[model samples]
Target chain A: MTSLPALPTPKKLGLVIDLDVCVGCHACVVNCKEWNTGGYGAALSDQDPYGADVSGAWLNRIHTFEVVPQGGEIVGEAGEARIVHFPKSCLHCEDAPCVTVCPTGASYKRADDGIVLVDEDMCIGCGLCAWACPYGAREMDLAAGVMKKCTLCIDRIYNETIAEIDRQPACVRTCPANARHFGDLADPSSAVSIMVAERGGMDLMPEQGTRPVNKYLPPRARKPLASSTPLPKEDTTGATGFFAWLDDMLDRI
Target chain B: MHPAPSIIIFTTLSGLGYGLAVVLGLGLLDPATLATKIAHVLAIAMIGAGLMSSTLHLGNPQRAWRALSQWRSSWLSREGVMSIVTFVPLLWSAWVCVIESRYLALPGLAGSVLSLATVFCTAMIYTSLKSVQAWHTPLTPACYLLFAAAGGLVVASLFAFAGGGNASLLAVLAAVALMAAWIAKTAWRRNMLTLVPISTPETATGLGAIGKVRLFERPHVMENYLTHEMGFKIARKHAAKLWGIAVVLGGAVPVVALLVLAIVGQVSSAIAAMFACVALLSHIIGMLTERWLFFAEARHAVMNYYNG
Candidate 1:
């Protein structure tokens, strides 16, 4: 059934991304593609590998933007323009349009974990599910002939054989900056939930009504340094002798 | 959004075919006539050909039948079911016209409603998509139904003229429908032009509190699937020229030809038939152009993130 099932105690297992430290390294994007391709659905296909058009079915991507600060006139040319690295993936929305719009019953949101997945066997590759997504999370695999998306590393997340510390999503586990967080957002007491509350994590495109489970913590407000210029030309070489002597006396004591 | 030829062909041909089915099912032209029988066959053939063309772009066309099982929530699935269901009555009506040489009211009326329903389902497939805000409107379905009706009337009148029947009334109706479809479509174009973008780069990235978000760099150096498929951009000036051409060819030429045929139809059957042919062909070419723009110009909300 394409209609979402009503589940009691459905755990919204999702990610909380911290934008402050994301550095736009694209490690998460690469790790996600590497893990998801070899694991769930079919291998994510690439159209061209070494050629000019090297497009592929990547599950995650990083987009860089220059913000002109709320009321600023200049765009990216301004000195104070803030740069943000946005890592995007499927948010595993509660009301996932991609799941409901599938002509085949291939796309479904898991009632047990709130993870959206595509059953490759039934996918017609009609590309309607990709179109329905407001976040551009889904991609049509050229070779596999199936829709590929972020499975939230379902195969790794629930695996028992792997060590507990390594059981998280490859993107989160492999993140060098600790930008990505994976936990049950449904539980208020979970670390991810508390972080979201404290840091004021927000949904990307909240107006779209996808009700995305994953939240993005906004970049910390940046302030200019108090003194960027040289202080009073500092009386040549070591002119403040009294303060220097006081520092030496304290060191001796 | 790629303006793919396969889809443009599918939507255009299916609309015209189903539109033809609409009038034929109502017994507009006599069922006993050879021309009417040919028209019936043409209608079914176009619908079949159109449905076939739609599967050309699918990666897993062999698994296309799986699409029929999920009509409960999917408009695309409903369209699949309706297209097949419509064939039953259409084939029956066509068989009766060819063999028995008469129109069956039960199947005829039922086929008409089903054909219209099929068009509605097809339109809803695009209209239901909230991701493409331009298409997420009642106007999508309204334009589809009007165009289908217009195309059907225009074709049905051609058969009416060929058969040497009372075609004047049919010609006038076809002309009016053609005019109305274009008028509604003009309004649709205006709506797209003056749209208040629901999602912007600022809102998409949740950076509105900070500043105007401008794309500094895309994730990939080359175009990815999202960029390739949804990044189709037509300049404003180019789009305006095409819109004017579409209106002139699809609306002005066909409507004028059809109106002229309504007057001189009975007096000069040969000349009227030529005029009807002009109306039919021009209307089709015009609709093809309009349908191409329908896909090309409409921006998807997901593109807000890409800012392409």
Candidate 2:
């Protein structure tokens, strides 16, 4: 039952995140939890919400990293260090090991749209799917005794009642900086696909060979800052004393 | 990977059980004997206890029967199916041996093959995981098979000594199996230590082009399922100490004990039986520790995202 689709899907609907504009505001993270908690996978339980060690199951998470360009100066008037805001969720991989490792057929990928999902009803909470995931995309809901993961907001994206413009993942709609884009990656002409092509989007851990559908656009290169005023040239003309030379230079300036 | 006690106990006890079943199925011990009957009963008990303990770790133990449906694709499911299927022949063989007081050749052979196959399936459950480099190796199954054989032989030796039949041969077999298990385990540990992680922070983020990357801040201030499940870390010194203990108790002590049985078994059958029991007990404890380390030491590929 956990076997993969015999044929690949035609439409690989996924996400393309732009790291350049992400401000690490965590709007995506917060909104994902909010929507998912009340939405399809309801009540993403938090253990000890007010206690010392707070832990819970969250589908989307953001990680901030400090990436310094190689052989670049440590400190400069122009920005030399880049702080990247990485928002991570399920990529709905074409070769998702998570889906294949499920013992009860709870985890699976849709052949029509290529959206990976978990069927809570069938899940026995063995947690093998989570272990098989290289992206850390799956989370086990201990209270519910089932695994939770990003479903790409299947309820909203395909819902006829929702407005067309709003028919996207909650995280994408909630991103304050408009850093997340959702569309069909299989179509070359799709907006998200075009953006990926233009921005040189890349897969995380290509060696793992999960073939993640989500792509991350690297941060843009920084432009050097131009100084407003040029320094005055030093006048080292014949001056007998230091004080006299300073006075003459000051007068000339 | 947290070393959950349920799984550790399941694998260890079940491995021992299946190993004993395989030995019994091979007609290594006399079928029309009280010692063989005791061994058969012990095997069934160990397997039943192990299978039951495995469900303790499941979130819905009542729904565990559903796990057998995916045997065509999942190793875990195959293990479940195989274990259940193996029990039929195993129980039949035991019944014939204990009740009829004779070995049923066909049923005994079938049970033996199925028992070993079930153990292979158990090993495949971990070996098939691509995300865990430490366990995704040929050595994993080899080690499992060897340890099971070694543990089974030691138990069989004890029964044989108690029954006053071929104690020296069983003891020698146990000794050889123990030595092989130890060598294979040592190799597995060495391989795991030397294996360069295919996944790293740079690869995980796909920003290796940006030079060295370090996490400045995490997504949340609190821990989450990913962190809790995959973030298990064991100190190097503690792991080394456990490794030493496991080798000494599980491998060396059993080997020495079995060797003593082989030498003094004819002269002092009572003393040899006692030594055999000691080896069995020590090996069980040692395997438990080894299984704990097995889980503790494995670094899941998902952990690279958390800088684990």
Candidate 3:
């Protein structure tokens, strides 16, 4: 059997989010916390629970937004609105400012995969990288005195021990809504790439020009305002006569 | 943006070093004197010490040597490399100045130019970080260079007054520099006062649609490290008070003091030295407060969630 190569071309690992199918559930968020807490590399720790204090570690979260009618190509009916649940995480920006701000080389974009990783050994907990990030993606592991963020399950995604199909990020695998897709964005033939081309997928804050790798496919147009099913004719005669007779008898009794 | 104590010390010390070098270099062009040699030595020592102090701010000082590797994209790396590159010439100039050799004087002049270039590069490091709005402007580098010269002039004035080496000219230069510093400081304050924070709730969330968004349910309850570091903010009222003190004690008072001494013809060595110390202390405190405000006042786009 041939041995797997030690290193590969820079893998542009990223997410492709489908807004059409997401049900606004927090399953991905909970699953991420569980998997990451017990994962091989880094752990997210929560400080307090209950008793006027509740906080838990999460790598991702689902945010619900009601996009009301606004001045744009997209618009709602006079009394209609659509609710979208956005799952937020690090974009793994092409022009990563966080890496540059790190006085120590602890925060670095890997040359092999372009994944931004922190060398925990060198991180001094200065938190300058956090300031440099426009997106509040990276969080400090207060207990560990190091920075932590969505690693895209670097260990799991490439593990040979796990089955090929199962070797994806926990969040992507557990997304019941099938809203999240993970793949190499550099490949023009990837499923995510095809979906993006078909559906007009766009990045958030394109103006900032972080060149975010993640793509959010806008909600596709509603299916031509489907015709309503006709209601049955009113059951007037028999029901009306019977009700009137029963009421009269009861009053007499 | 907080201008940590280590950084403040580093910049101030190195600035003085470069400033003194400028004046001493000018002196060399005129004539070779023992006084110029002493000044040259002093400048080298100051620059060396300041550079050493800067290393303390680094998380991994040992990896400092590796900073030269990424000069392709980073101004910071360029600064690190330039600082080292200039040092060799500086040492050479010091040697020539000490030995009083006309043969090496030309090289000494070249070293002085190199030193100024390195100082300008260092200033640009701060000027380049676009995120730090306060330090991002062209005025930033200009102010740094000018302030360094102003500090050097004050020191030189003290020396001139003590040694009776044309105290009048030095005092006049000090007075003029102090006034210019005062004007620059006022402009800096004005710019900061009007500056707005970049981060907003809509921006942080990457939603083009904007109205308002608050942290209805915070991702975490207890203060995380992000809150401790990037979430720092000072009340508007307190910042104003600090600014007032910074402007008065840091800017106005120094100019007035220097002018008063010069007008009275009491620009003696002791008085000039005292004024320099006073001005230095004022500027230091002002810069500290200004830097604090720089960080504190900046509203990170992340903060929009909290504020909204």
Model 2 residue runs over 4 Å out of place are A71-79, A223-253
Q: Global CA lDDT of candidate 3, please?
A: 0.64
lDDT of 3 at B235: 75
Candidate 1: which docking quality band?
Answer: medium
Rank ordering of all candidates by DockQ, starting from the highest: 1, 2, 3
Kindly list the per-residue Cα lDDT of model 2 for residues B1-308, writing each as its tens digit: 88989999999999999989988988989888899998998998999999999998787677788899888888999999999999998999999988998888888899889988999999999999888999999999999999998888889999898872588898899889989998999999999999999988888887778767778788888777877777888999999999999999999898898887688657566676777888889999999999999999999987776778
Chain A TM-score values for every predicted structure, listed in order = 0.89, 0.86, 0.81
Docking quality band of candidate 2, CAPRI definitions: medium
TM-score-better candidate, 1 vs 2: 1
The order by descending lDDT is 1, 2, 3
Better of 1 and 3 by TM-score: 1
Number of the predicted model whose lDDT against the real structure is largest: 1
The DockQ of each candidate is 0.76, 0.68, 0.18
The superposed Cα distance between candidate 1 and the true structure at residue A149, in angstroms, equals 0.3
Question: What's the CA error at residue B243 for candidate 2, in Å?
Answer: 0.8
Error of 3 at B214 (Å): 5.1
